[model samples]
Target: MDINLVLSELQKQNKSVYKNVFNQFYKGMVLYANNFLFDQQTSEDIVQEVFIWLWENAKNIEINTSLKSYLYAMVRNRCLNYLKSIKITDDLNLIDLNSALLLEEDIDNISEDEKAIIYRQILKIVEGFPASMQQIFKLKFVENYKYNEIADELGISVNTVKTQLKRAKLKIGESIPLLLALFLHH
Candidate 1:
């Protein structure tokens, strides 16, 4: 499916095409939102809200960029706005804002090979997490396993799996800027 067609279809009020786009992009967009908020439910809610708004105003909305870029930018802005609404002065949230900026653009300046190396370094950071935490993190994000699936395989509760994943996101999130700096210095 060509994502480029999404804009034209939505403009034409093509419900089927809209559903297809949602199915194709929803999971990835949710993950992208999670990278900012680190709260699964809220991330899902934010993405849902974005999609709802998209459909409700599809005919009126103007998107000059690719649908992927527009969708991600919307999610990123919402996530950052949520963080600000809570309290922007907090130091941890400041770190999150930095991470959001880096992620929202997906580091477009870097080549695919550079991104792979950065991903490897990020994995090294994940390696520093506790054994089970690292395992659960990899299973969820790398393998795209659901919480229940991860819980079942690890013989742990879903809540436990969620907690570990959250911690993993936070830890890895904190290192994003530093890693970007490292990559830039090279």
Candidate 2:
């Protein structure tokens, strides 16, 4: 169960060796991940995922230095990414809260229930949009696609794609100002 033996076994793609490796490093990896991510469960999940990825990509993975250092580095980066995502979600939630606060004075005009209903309606509308439009919107908004990339994939002129995107945003702006505001405000 030595480190060198584990690495050699892993390089040879031996599945049995992973049990021992996981047992030996699981606690240390979780602790390392928790240093950045703060949540114990998330840290453990990230560590597990990193180990799984290591196993899957073991053939191409060149361990020049100690396996421990490599594993620790992977755990650290994954933890940092998890922390960053949490920060982003927190910021978006804060914007939603601020929007609620701003609309609070007109409570009778726009109740929280009404806001939820409107959001659901907007989601339905997006679902009903043309497949091409839906894909473009998802790539641009959800997957963060660049104009050039989207154009290349869609096999359309850049300006035409940009125009379509602009029209889509304008339509959304008019149909669902709250949702558009939230996206832009973020």
Candidate 3:
């Protein structure tokens, strides 16, 4: 099938044409995704997801290259993103392990009422952050969200999420010690 014809059908929202494209390219795209993810099921899922996204966004898609290249690039990008999210989860596990003991020691010593007081003060510090930074901070730390998840939910890029988080951490680090020292001393 001609790429231009397929794209033309796509713009017209032709379901049969979309199905034909899916049938033609699905297997190769899955294999391409599996090259990076090493998981057949996940690769298939990603490929299917790409097809869905392509279908949904057909009207807006502008392909300067061949359709094959565009579809392959989408699969490849999705695979890389999957790997990145996995790495982030692993890194978060390591961070959690490193911090658990310190948190446990300090938390064990504090009364529930005092902990509430500390939480309120910490919330105050967080509230003072820039709007976007404060929302990202709460979504990530308090709500236990991943960086990409926060970015997707907030409609920002991953780099922007990381930058905001870095700045938030610095600000929190500057504020938290005084609050902690006041509590930990008593």
Off by over 4 Å in 1: 1-4, 88-90, 93-186
When sorted by lDDT, best at the front, the candidate numbers are 3, 1, 2
Instruction: Order the candidate numbers by TM-score, best to worst.
Output: 1, 3, 2
Give Cα-based local distance difference scores for all models.
0.74, 0.65, 0.75
**C-alpha root-mean-square deviation, candidate 2:** 11.7
Any residue pairs clashing in model 3, and if so which? none
Best by TM-score: 1
TM-score of 2: 0.45
Worst 10 residues of 3 by lDDT: 89-98
What global local distance difference test value does model 2 have?
0.65
Worst 10 residues of 1 by lDDT: 89-98
Residue 117, model 2, lDDT: 56
lDDT of 3 by residue, 1-186 (tens): 687888989989999999999998999999888766555677999999999999999988989898999999999899989978755322222222225312334544656666656555555666678778988976787567898999999999999999998887677667666656666678
Compared with the true structure, what per-residue lDDT tens digits does model 2 show for residues 136-169? 7656654567888888988987897777766665
Question: Clashes in each model (backbone N, CA, C under 3 Å)?
Answer: 0, 0, 0
